[model samples]
Target: MENVEQEFLSVIREYERVIYKVCYLYTTPNATLNDLYQEVVLNIWKAFPKFRRECKISTWIYRIALNTCISFIRKEKNIPEIVTLTQEADRSEEDDETQAMLQQLYRMINRLGQLEKSIILLYLEEKSYEDISEITGLTVTNVATKLNRIKDKLKKMNKED
Candidate 1:
């Protein structure tokens, strides 16, 4: 039992950043980042024992995290939250521009529906369409189609600003 617990902890440690990115992107006022993070970790733990080696560990983790966050949103009946990245108040001019763009991208992403956000987030992480399909339970063709649409939607958002 202790060994199982330790092994699970190591999995969490290995995927900590990936888990947190999913939580951060899915965060809302109703479900704070920490709240979502806890939920994802808990879900991962519950599912860990039964995890078959049929899929990649990262895919399994993303599936759990995305589903947990999406279900939480549905139960809360709350809107998606815009995530702002924190940087030191004093920063270089180039850094400020880069930060602003990232914030804008996050803002646009926040405006997306839950599934859309999940697809786009996976896309940004450089997951192939097949990997995204696996994680999101969408077909590879569907993932590619949605990626194109999401890109166009984001472009429209930029134009609107």
Candidate 2:
């Protein structure tokens, strides 16, 4: 394989979980997971050659993944308003109660708007506010404010559930 191809593959392998999680969270009934995943990889590959060492690779990849999914949804007129994420990534070994709780959480998350969902996902990934801001192109203060609002929204959702 060419050096660039090899490097791209390496980066994708290293960040596959991030890519998959983003795709998984954005999948809708019309936009299947595999379809979204393939489109994201394709986008990353197309832009790999032009990617300079300006920002963190993870941030770039996250941007591409999110943009790809969001654009695909927009093209398909799908905003991913449904929550059908499977127990395929992790926590498959959790007890039934834990799994149920997780499903409920996913359902609530799926109800959020695209930006809100993205912020919450990054927060759950343990990304710092700075990192989230970098990936999301939001100011640190905006990320913090939105995060607090998202948390309150989630809490309200849980209470109403």
Compared with the true structure, model 2 gives a TM-score of 0.93
Per-residue lDDT of model 2, residues 9-127, tens digit only: 99999999899999988888778888999999999999998999698899899889988988888887634457565866467578778888888888999888889988999899898
Error of 1 at 87 (Å): 5.9
Which digits, one per residue and each the tens of the lDDT, describe model 1 over residues 1-161?
Answer: 89889999999999988888888877777888889999999999999889998999999999999999888888876454576654322335557677788879888998898899999999998999999999998999999999999999999999999
lDDT of 1: 0.87
> All models: lDDT?
0.87, 0.88
* Model 1 steric clash total: 0
Candidate 2, clashing residue pairs? none
User: Top lDDT: which candidate number?
Assistant: 2
Instruction: Mark the regions of model 1 whose C-alpha exceeds 4 Å error after superposition.
Output: 79-81, 87-94
Question: C-alpha displacement of 40 in model 2, angstroms?
Answer: 0.5
